[model samples]
Target: MPAQEDSSTRVLEDLDAAAVDYATRIAGASGPARAALRDELTRICLPFAGRMARRYRGRGENLEDLEQVARLGLVKAIDRYDPERGSFTAYAVITISGEIKRHFRDRTWGVHVPRRVQDLSLEVGHASMVLTTELSRTPTPAEIAARLNVSLPAVLEALESAAGYSPSSLNAPAGGDGAAEFGDLLGGTDSDLEMVDDKLTVAGLLLRLPARERRMLAMRFYGNRTQAEIATELGISQMHVSRLLSRSLAWLREAMLNDTLPRWEGANGPTDPHGMQIAVQSGGGVVTVQVRGEVDRDTAERLRTVVRHAVSSLAGRGLVIDLAAVPLVDAAGVAVLLDAASAAAVAEAELTLTGAQPYVARILGVSGLQSLMR
Candidate 1:
């Protein structure tokens, strides 16, 4: 025991000497020498930062981020450390721990909390640690309140706020075998499936429409072809095309609201086709395609087909695709748009996109398609 104590004393003395040397150099040196001394000091104290950071592990924040925070705190402590006032290690531990606590208080709260409550939460935590150490047991809220000279209710509130400091991930492992995630145990309806149901209902309703009306609707909405173009293509007068479009849209709206359409006859049911409604309108040498519903791999082919048909028929006129009603667009859908744009460019026609949802717009921006959007 005497030999061990001697060895421990020597190690501490060496650390103290190093700290003093670093401090003296840091204070007296200038320029490159000062930077070198700071680097040396940081290297010497890195282990202390790591030790302090380890105390904050398993608290939701990444270990690497916490270590970085602790290192920052160590640097601050070293710059401000007064050897005449205290031991360097003790000062560093306090500063590093404070930094970790501050990180939790400022950033880790999943919800907004009052500043008073946030500060109190930290105080309560410190009190609990002190009480736990002294009593050799986990401290109750009442014990912590007494130790901190705070009311029991305040302590309880602080304790509650502490839970917000580290919200667990829903994807975290839950079951013993780790086969299930915490999200699997949570209860909530899948909203995307609900959207799929609505789309399927719409598809069923579309199937009820006549083939001519379906083709006209597709040309007007998806091909961005005007009533004149649709009429010319269908061998009908412009007035008749307008009347047909109005009637078809009204029927679709009523069918969607009242569920008046019969079920789809497809073997795979309503959502099997997983297609979107595209209406094209052409007038004054411009074609507009209005796209509705999700645009993913399954629906992208239909989009490509309609756009290609419209671009071919437009004779170099501009094309505008309105996507206000499109809730989602995947990579395949984006690819289809890019390919259509390329085709239109090759045909010496201008293509403009409008009414993209924020998410779709972000995707377009990221994919370098923002230049094509109007």
Candidate 2:
């Protein structure tokens, strides 16, 4: 066994030596010689695929998707690498992270969890953030447990879950306000600016959510599913889905809505306003308002304003309020929505709700809108 193992190691060493030689030659040459580097890059990046994939084990994202994203990042790093500046590890780290961030910004999750659990996830994240900042470094689970007053196992669990979580995406363009955008988080590189917009960071928000709620949010948003469909798929009552949605939306609003500029926002400005999308202006019937946090009565009031603004121009078009993407909302949302629909009707427009969710649907049904919807 020892002889065989040594021989296998020597064979690997010989292959590595030949690969490096080929890569170094390709790096110095132009044109077709660059082709030689491709195989070497594929070989070098094979190991990184697992490491990055491991980082994403707990989040509800698909392993295949994670591996694909990581692989693309690795390839990109190899292609764009410049030996003039730094080590391969540093470059690869940035590359893999950048790719992951893009996925976080653009992709939705594959599973759902509960609202209380979602909020707990957020609290755990906050605790980690506070502990990291206060300690000026990453803290052990025991240390985190001490600070959070939770069990060490809980702290470990949070860390493990968060390991798969992508940091908030910074996809806004440079300088709507010139510095309040999330693109600033990656140090305002023109290259990074082209990635997904920070405003689209629904993925990171989902990770902060409780596991079950996160799963539900994934199915609803990414799946573009109707409440009834979601209910049937999850084997739960539509009313239950609606309720879970309401709670989760409130949590999402809390995670996504911001008053002060986030650290990343200092360099990248806000995205093109909601009205800039051709979909919004061409009467496509979509409205995106930046509701600050916690979709309770107050946020619901704000949402009413958004709904009014969205429908003000369409005037009798099918009114589809998109709540499929939010992380939280509450019981008050039903009243606000019903009121908005009434207000829209008063303006002589019909409101055809598309994403009423199970809980929200039940609330409306129980509140006497079932016959109206039918």
Candidate 3:
């Protein structure tokens, strides 16, 4: 035993010397030099880490994971340690133990408990074990609380929280017969089945729209193509695309809410030199209007007109204005959205603004029209 003690003391002294040297070299070193020194220090400290990790071996975590945690803690301690503070061994032990405790606190909790309660539980557990050994009897909560200089209620709460340390698996056996699993006894209902009729109705409605409108909807939503890309493909101005899109969406909104087919007015309409393009699609009792280009003083009235048309035509279905492609929106554009929202409210229909670009969203946010967005 004396020989073993002598060997242990020598090993500790050597490790401490090595730690101080690494700290001094790492302080002056940079780039590859610092990295190599850190690697060497880590190797020297690994055995200390393993020793610390062994303290937590019987816990739920794998021994290897705990060792890795301890090593990480050692690396951090090495980086942060000042040789002036004291011996490396003491600092390493504290840092390594803290890292292991943190791992257990963060990862092992089956249910979330307050950090204070978790810490108290650990203290209470350790104290109870010590008291039980000393007294040769189980320690009461009051005794543990007095020993720890805490309230009895706090001790009781900590003791109660011990059960949450390890949660039962969902796959565990449900009963003593072992015929059923816990998961088998649980019940759930599929909510998606409720929307089948609505989906079918929307699919039929989509089929009735003009071929051009259908293609535009497919490209915008399915292909995820920008309005500019769609405009380039169709050889039309982005503004023209916006208007066509809006008018198309408004018509579909009217049809779905009224449960009637829309009369096809040919796609050709009066061109605006400074107006946004609008595309509309309807499904599942909601009509989505895709607006592109700028919405400022010049084009705000056009937006109001198109949205008002949609609101007027719909009986009860909701309308969503999508502004994902609109690069800019000003005060006038915000007014148009507010007006549309108010009109929808009066009509007893919900209006939602969807996919506004950042600049456009910021404008709406400043104007307090953000509440209308979904």
User: Best lDDT goes to which candidate?
Assistant: 3
User: What digit string (tens of lDDT, one per residue) describes model 3 on residues 63-100?
Assistant: 99999999999999988888898998889889998988
Worst 10-residue lDDT window, candidate 3? 264-273
Counted clashes in each candidate structure: 16, 41, 10
Candidate 1: tens digits of C-alpha lDDT, residues 42-117: 8887887887898867656799999999999999987888889778877887898888888877877887798889
Model 2: per-residue Cα lDDT at residue 33: 60
lDDT of 1: 0.80
Clash tally for model 2: 41
lDDT of 2 by residue, 9-63 (tens): 6654654454455557885887766775686657756766657766755455688
- Order of all candidates by lDDT, from best down to worst? 3, 1, 2
Query: Model 3 lDDT vs. the true structure?
Result: 0.81
Clashing pairs in 3: 242-277, 242-278, 243-277, 243-278, 245-278, 245-279, 245-280, 246-278, 246-279, 249-280
Off by more than 4 A, model 1: 1-12, 122-139, 147-149, 167-374
Looking at model 3, residue 79 earns an lDDT score of 87
Error at 101, model 2, angstroms:
2.9
Arrange candidates by TM-score, descending.
Answer: 3, 1, 2
Candidate 2 local Cα displacement, residue 316, angstroms? 79
